[model samples]
Target: MKTQKAIYQSSLPSNTRNKLVLRRTRKRFNPKIFINRTIETTAIVSLLFTGFTGAGAMGCWGMEIAMSSRNWQHQKNICLGMMLVSFSGFLGSALIGASFSIQRDKF
Candidate 1:
């Protein structure tokens, strides 16, 4: 059986080696695609966070209403604040996505 090093050492022709080098060198970074994907990912994550926080806020509000407790009221306020922040994040990401889509169409 051929050893791994021996197999690896079996040299290719110069043309094939040059082709491989050229292929490696041809890769390029695309900022537009990268930014679009990043915005999309942020939008998705923030939307999820908004959903979760909104649910928590509703639950706290319901408990405060049912129990008439000041502690629950405070917790409900905090949950509402978190939900609002996450919602804002989702909105910002959505705006960025929309702007990017428009820019792409223009170009």
Candidate 2:
């Protein structure tokens, strides 16, 4: 079996045998890409949260409708609040994503 160094060196030309192999440099942190990724993640998470809370609110409202008691009012209110908050977050993130796309296109 060939050694790892010998396998790698076998592919190079004879003229380059004495030259040093330069490794690729690491990329610098880009804030624009980071911000775009963050916005995309936030949008997806908020959309999922909104869907869950909206379903909960619907379920609570359904229970309230089927039962004669008003015990689900507080829970329904909480669900509605959470749903609204998550929906707003989703919208805000979506808007930010759109703005970023527009900015990228402009340059």
Candidate 3:
């Protein structure tokens, strides 16, 4: 029995052991929230757009303007927030667009 436990313990790498410990510790102390796949995908797409726009804005307008006019620590954060907003907009538009694009057959 001792040997079985020893073998099991030895099989886990230190990083895996650390991660398991961290998970257990977090479960005891925190309320775990998981984002659904659709939400995650939407966030990613939004962020991508936000980043693209923000970077384009920065290049066109200059970082100094972003820093002086905005309180965001970096242009990146501003970009991220814009991304989230765009994502939300896109998610709504996609749902509507999808509904419109669907074809129904009438007998």
Candidate 4:
């Protein structure tokens, strides 16, 4: 019981009775880690692309249903907008990915 108490006290860093220091592997700080993590832009852009594409798909589906009912006039504009946005999002993602690839290759 005394040994157990002594061990417990030693485990505490601030304990004055039996001193024990817990050492951990220290990783050197790197500026690159901060810069790399701070601007995680790819995820945001990918999510934007996903949302735009999903909205576009919904718009196209709406247009299809509207056309079937012969109410195509109003849906035409919306559907077109959706398709355009979807196309742009897909194009943008592709371009961004390509640009990154090119940059990696260049250096």
Q: Pick the candidate with the highest TM-score.
A: 2
- Rank list by TM-score: 2, 1, 4, 3
Superposition TM-score, candidate 3 onto the true structure: 0.31
lDDT of each: 0.79, 0.84, 0.54, 0.57
lDDT of 1 by residue, 18-91 (tens): 34331222345799889988998988998898888888889988999999999988998998898888889989
Q: Write the per-residue lDDT of candidate 3 for residues 1-107, one digit (tens) a residue.
A: 11211222436787676343312222332322232345456656766786687675566356556556454345546665676689676777567445534532222
- Clashes in model 1: which pairs? none
Q: Which runs of model 3 end up more than 4 angstroms from their true locations?
A: 1-48, 54-74, 103-107
What order do you get sorting by lDDT, best first? 2, 1, 4, 3
lDDT of 4 by residue, 40-102 (tens): 464456457657655665765677685675455445556556656655655765676666557
TM-score per prediction, in order, is 0.70, 0.74, 0.31, 0.37
Per lDDT, the best of the predicted structures is 2
CA deviation > 4 Å runs, candidate 1? 1-26
Candidate 1 minimal-lDDT segment of 10 residues: 1-10
Estimate candidate 1's alpha-carbon lDDT, on a 0 to 1 scale: 0.79
Clashes of 3: 0
